[model samples]
Target chain A: MAMLTDLLVISAANRIIGLIRDVFVALDPDTAQAVEVLLYFLVMVLYAILCELLLNGQTLGKRIFKLRVVDASGLRLEPSQVIIRNLLRLVDGLPMFYLLGGITCLLNTRMQRLGDIAASTVVVRIPEVSHPDLDNVLGSKYNSLLEHRHLCARLRQRVTPEVAAIALEALTRRDRLDPVARLKVFAGLAAHFRELVDFPAAATESLGDEQYVRNVVEILYRAG
Target chain B: MLIDLPRFVNAERPHWQALEAILKRFENDPDLRLPIDEAQRFHYLYQRTGSALSRISTFASEPELKQYLEWLVSRAYSIIHGQAERRRFHPWRWFTVTLPTTFRRRIQAFQMSLALTVLGALFGVIALAIDPEAKSALMPFSHLTGRPSERVAQENADRGKRLEGRKTTFSASLMTHNTKVAIFTMGLGISYGLGTIVLLFYNGVILGAVAFDYVMDGQTIFLLGWLLPHGVIEIPAILLGGQAGFIIAHALIGWGDRRITRAQRIREAAPDIVTIIAGAGVFLIWAGIVEAFFSQYHEPVVPYGIKIAFGCVEFAGLIFFLWKGGANSEQNNSSKA
Candidate 1:
């Protein structure tokens, strides 16, 4: 929905700009030729500048919707990559409104539009909340109900220092993990902690080990 | 954390009763917010959901996991879809990348078009040389006969005397005629192949006959003065246009007895056709400028040399630049595979 809206906005902007340029040229025949050439160069330059600076490496519409452009590895996109991707829009938009491009994107695993395939970039949503920020729940209004530092010490007793450390590290660097690896690490830690806490099987399964681990951390932080 | 216990527990399960007992204990303890351990547990559960969702391959047949899977899928879909929306409208970055590639491709196509045109021209000249009588058959006799030639000479002298009064209609008429001829030469290529050949032959015969007439009229100097100035650029443009026509024909007609679908052939040929048309436009523009300004009033010696130099440049430029397809390196690597 956001991507579609962004596209609409950009298309509208393009049409408006084109109309303005046309009107400017029509006012003076001799000057119109010169203006036409100048406008073409100007439009190209403006497009580059707007995309690089304002969009977080995305174009104006992209920035508005909190979308980010990244490389195949999901790192920040390079300017050249951005350029290549945008330029391939011609191919994407070829023979009409991106029919070929849309097909290519549908066929690809990454769901790359024509430009993305050509430029080798991916568009991904920036996570709204980082894992570490979950710790802040302890400091919120619920602090009186739970103690954080004592719970951390209790957690330390339940699990080896090394295991706790690994869990903390995994959460801190969650972004680095592929989805599968992240799940495995989190699930393993949760299950281990659940055994130490000796929660009933019914509670353990329903809440799940991973959720249980998160609840412990949050409760401890609030109590601190 | 306000855990939604009812949503997760199956009422019929014996374990659900035990889970409710534990939940009741926590509920009675007014100070018991979710434990830190519990929060960590939930976090891990969320991560598991993400992982399971990501491993779409494993869940292909697991109908029981559909609801959980749908949740995960929707979240990921929203993220990606949102990102796409943001980037869709702002094509400047994409345009930057695409424009240069398009430009380079177009330029390369133009060069190929030029080379093919020269080859076509050479073939037409050969055809003319082989059948000299065809040259006379194609030539415009009104411009060549003694009385008409003498009358033209008188008119030229009168025009020179009253230079400012001379009508530009003559130049306009010539322009119109040349443009029509060029278009016919190019457009007939659509007739599969024969039309292109005929166009090429007609052009070659006319050029040869014109040269022959000038040489016979003891006005070789005048002919050089008149034709050389614009012929240099104009002739190559026409020849290149002819070449573009020939390429279109070749693309339409498969080279050998390979069974290829017409649609497949057209798709493969689309890029070349676009390139040819673009090249033709450029050539026509250059031809117009040359004929309008330079051809009508240039010194014989300089114009003749310019004409020869222009032809050589066309030949060298095309051969050096466009013959190697851009995918050659990729092909080499792929062959190793």
Candidate 2:
């Protein structure tokens, strides 16, 4: 995601630069050619240095591809390495297509292209996950097991950590289990704690066994 | 700290269960509220939920469960951010990304300018060839032609003596005339494309007539000496100036009434105008240099050959450097996105 954003930004910037160059040329065709050549050289140098050094070896294009360039030791790449990697772009672009480099990425486990290998960089997806409000968990717009606030409060107080852990494990493994098997696992866990808590015999059926187990754990934890 | 247990239970069993346990334990814990920035919050959510969510396909057999899970996620997001609505999409942001790509794609206009100039020059030559009398007809003065041969020789001798004596004034007048001509060519090039064509046509006709006049007078050699030195740069510079005019005119027309908002058009046209003005400056400067130096030097064969060589080099260089399509490999890569 970060790589995609960075690539989009860089692409936008490149277009602005190209437009400026065009205006210069339009103003004076005779001198615009020289200005264009100079501008191209400058842009190339800037791309190599900024992308390789400051950006940790990820050009806008590379970033969009969810890749980064790092040294052999998995550290930020050096300026010389960045230059070499970029210069090698011409080579990677050889043989009439990007076939050579594209094939390398396809075969590699980490998806490192020639440029990545040369610059010693790898691209990894960065994930995000952290919710701050625990109170809203039971009251969540998504929860349906406990409809009333009082019922949710009562269940939160009765739930226990052990039951919560078991419920989480069961839920995580739920995909591999048949519906009957999944219910059995939740019922079994709920049964272990049923003696310590007051609840209806059919509570596990109305409230999904997973939800039942989770409610038991939440109630126990709140009480403790 | 109020918990809506019903909605949580209605969500996908796995996510709901996992979330329920966490929320129940931390429900009343004030210390769980970490005062982190929004970016950090998003990052944390992405890391935790992305991994967990990736483990299971959210395609539940129960439609209510699927809807509940979607609602739960969205509600959680809203609670964290304090906003249920997404930010509005600003078109300018997209324009910024796309505008540059569009401007750089104007190699077509440059090619058109080159083609028009060449065609105009070609037609001018053809027109001059079809009308032999047109050359003398266009000349402003005809009284000097009525004099006898000897009298004309005497008059030329006297005028040459006078010109030698007042060299500074004569040179100043010539400079003034050249400056006026160059300026006129540059300024008139802005008449949509017509002005540029007219400039090219007139310049071409003048060139053909001068050459033809010298040939008729049996002084073709002298004509070559008189014109070639400066005509090389002068002619091309005039054509370029005219081309710049055509570019500006085309840009104005191309930006015509479109659904694109007014503000967007302004932003788009600003850069184009800047480029055209800059190019015009270059053309003017080159014209000044050629007029002051080359045009002043009325040498024989050497100067003529040098001028012709410069013209050939300029033509070839423009074609080579501005050779569209293949030069934009970097752009091609960016465009793939």
Candidate 3:
């Protein structure tokens, strides 16, 4: 993605240079060439700066990859910070090919390059988020656990958020699991929940391990 | 400790939405400054939302709600605690007030940069004086390998004609190359000052060796004419680069207060480092133009005395600028008082 960003920036710079040169056809050949080189350098330096600023801390490449440059302190990135970090590319590119920058990034705890350290910026990946479809997973099944309101309340209280999440995930992904693994997972979850809250023998005797787990999930997620 | 996840989310969703709306405004337009009442309301929403997130954090059901609240609280925390404000930039004030003031503030780093260069220059002079055979090794450039007298004669004979058609190209190359060197010098400060020191010293060595060789060959007038016009600005620009580098090194080393973290120190020094380097870059551009267009013309085409005088004037102007450029600004006055 970084390399792709570099290629896009270079291509854009070359196109701009060509357009400018065409407009100034009467210029001396050496002077024209000088302008091209100077413009190329300027564009190369400013490309990231402009893109990051205008696009909310993302270059074209970073945007494509859902990566962003943010303030390491968890604040909004300041313009001066942007300029300082980008300018430090001169040092990062030192000895050639960003070797120095790459080494510094590897050594640093936050994976920040020298430029990032100086500027107090960090590049982070933005994860894609969507609400889990609870209705689809926990259908309107006849939950025998809901019959004992007292035990259902107790079960919700005793179950930790982490444990609840694991149960929910297991139920949601049950189809993807093999039959033996699926049975084993439900057995484990039912045992854990059963220990947390004891339902009566009448509520337990008729329910299979899978159906028992499903009833618990529905009770935990849905209201009567 | 018990949480009714649906009821809790239902009660707090409006506050979370309000806070998100405010944050979206800040994010979309970083320079936006809210009115006092609006700002207070924003603060209220953040605190309220934060309180709600803490309550639901331990709840077992509704992981999606927990994640959403965590995201909101994190954004609010960043916005509320951020030290830097997005202000409009004024270039004239930056050059006159900010640049010189920053230079004055970080003068110690500049002094260290100067000291290292001088020490390196002294080393170069002694080494060359003792072993003239090391001239080729000391001066890496092919043009500088020959005797100074011969090079001066060749330059005089050309009378600036050598750069007639390609002056702009030469100038552009000089500007870009010198600017890169300056930036590289400053960037090396990340090495905790070691790399910066070595680079500055190496630069001084080359300068000293070349000057000594020219003076010894009885071509002092020609050398001065050739170098002074651009050297006056170019040398100081390089020094500014060194100065910025030393500043970074000092911050990393925590030379002063032990209480401040490395990140805080670097953050505080960032604006000044940027100011000095930008100033150096501007100076280099001017020096590049002068070196290609004016310094190359020697003897009959452009007299040595005029070139030397021009360099002196430039030196004086630069010193005056750095010493007292923004001394009378309103902000400076208020600070002084």
Task: Find the candidate with the highest lDDT and give its number.
Answer: 3
CA deviation > 4 Å runs, candidate 1:
A1-27, A33-50, A53-56, A73-76, A130-196, A199-217, A220-224, B1-337
**CAPRI-style class, candidate 3:** medium
A1-224: candidate 1 lDDT, tens digit per residue: 55476567656656665676578655654344444443443344346435643454556556666676665543334444564455445446545877977887889898877556434466766444222444532233332213334434344344543454455566667678998887887788777776665544543455644455555554322222
Instruction: Please provide TM-scores, in order, for all candidate models, with all chains considered together.
Output: 0.36, 0.31, 0.93
Give me the candidate number with maximum TM-score.
3
Compared with the real two-chain complex, what DockQ does model 3 have?
0.55
The positional error of residue B127 in candidate 3, measured at the CA in angstroms, is 1.3
Global lDDT scores for all candidate models = 0.48, 0.46, 0.85
Q: Kindly list the per-residue Cα lDDT of model 2 for residues A87-164, writing each as its tens digit.
A: 444434445455766777899887765545534445543122232233533333343333344644544444443445
Whole-structure CA lDDT of model 1: 0.48
Q: Per-residue alpha-carbon lDDT of model 1 for B90-150, expressed as tens digits?
A: 3442223322233344453335444544554465456546765555455556555443356
Please give the ranking of all candidate structures by TM-score, highest first, separated by commas: 3, 1, 2
Which digits, one per residue and each the tens of the lDDT, describe model 2 over residues B173-269? Answer: 3433443344344334333456556666666555655555556566554455435544554454455445444544553354555666432332334
| Candidate 2 steric clashes | 54
lDDT of 3 by residue, B61-103 (tens): 6566677777777777777787647568899999988899889
